[model samples]
Target: GYHELRHRRVYDRIWIEYHLIFSDDTSLQTSHDISHRIEDQVDHLFRKDEVIITAHLEPESHEPQFASTRDEHERSPLPSREVGP
Candidate 1:
């Protein structure tokens, strides 16, 4: 039962991101509906067309896992992008 939420304002526009925790057995449809309702409620409460919200649904029983490859990827530098030849 944990959640992380963050919000920021850019030129009078509100941007919000958060994660919603649900039981691992919860159906995808239910989780989607919940996220939709939250988005709607936040939009209505803010009463601003510029308000943007992002909600990530996650399982409450999630097991944190770490892999050496993942750690290496994080530490590795990004590949350079070649522009015009």
Candidate 2:
């Protein structure tokens, strides 16, 4: 399952973040596949060149918490990729 963590505009580009929580039994490959599909959908919904998506994958048992401040969020360790042309 997944949840949209936040969305904000940085300059002229839009940034969207999501938390993709998976059960302990879920495989890494499966998680990557799901995240990619989500990225695709988001790309299709918005102007590809103007949107950036940051997806974080977490184990279901882990506590669901977000950065306490925007500065922290910007420095998050999660991998982020630009998703459009």
Candidate 3:
């Protein structure tokens, strides 16, 4: 599960940032290697030096876990009010 994710494109450059969750028993080196593979996959898609992708590794036990969704804010229970039309 991921708590945060961001994607941005400016001009000819692309940027991606997301958090990756791994089992608590995973070693640091293994996690590092996994992140590298993920990065390589992203690099393959962009195939450009201008593109940057950052993946932060975290244990599955991390607190307050939540999945990133397409319309997260829209799904919130809070209601919007308009005044002074």
Best by lDDT: 2
Q: Rank the models by lDDT, top first.
A: 2, 3, 1
Which residue ranges in model 3 land beyond 4 Å of their true spot?
1-3, 64-85
In terms of lDDT, model 2 sits at: 0.68
- Cα deviation of 12, candidate 2, in Å: 4.1
Task: Give stretches of model 1 more than 4 Å off.
Answer: 63-85
Instruction: Tell me which of candidates 1 and 3 scores higher on lDDT.
Output: 3
TM values, all candidates: 0.67, 0.65, 0.68
By TM-score, the best candidate is 3
Better of 1 and 3 by TM-score: 3
Q: Any runs in candidate 2 off by more than 4 Å, and if so which?
A: 10-12, 64-85
The global Cα lDDT (0 to 1) of model 3 is 0.63
lDDT string for model 2 (1-85, tens) is 5556798887768889878777667799998897787777676667635889999997766734532232344432334454555
Clashes of 1: 0
lDDT of 1 by residue, 1-85 (tens): 2245788988869998877666678899998886776676677666745898888877755623322233433321213332221
As a TM-score, model 1 comes out at 0.67
Candidates in order have lDDT scores of 0.62, 0.68, 0.63
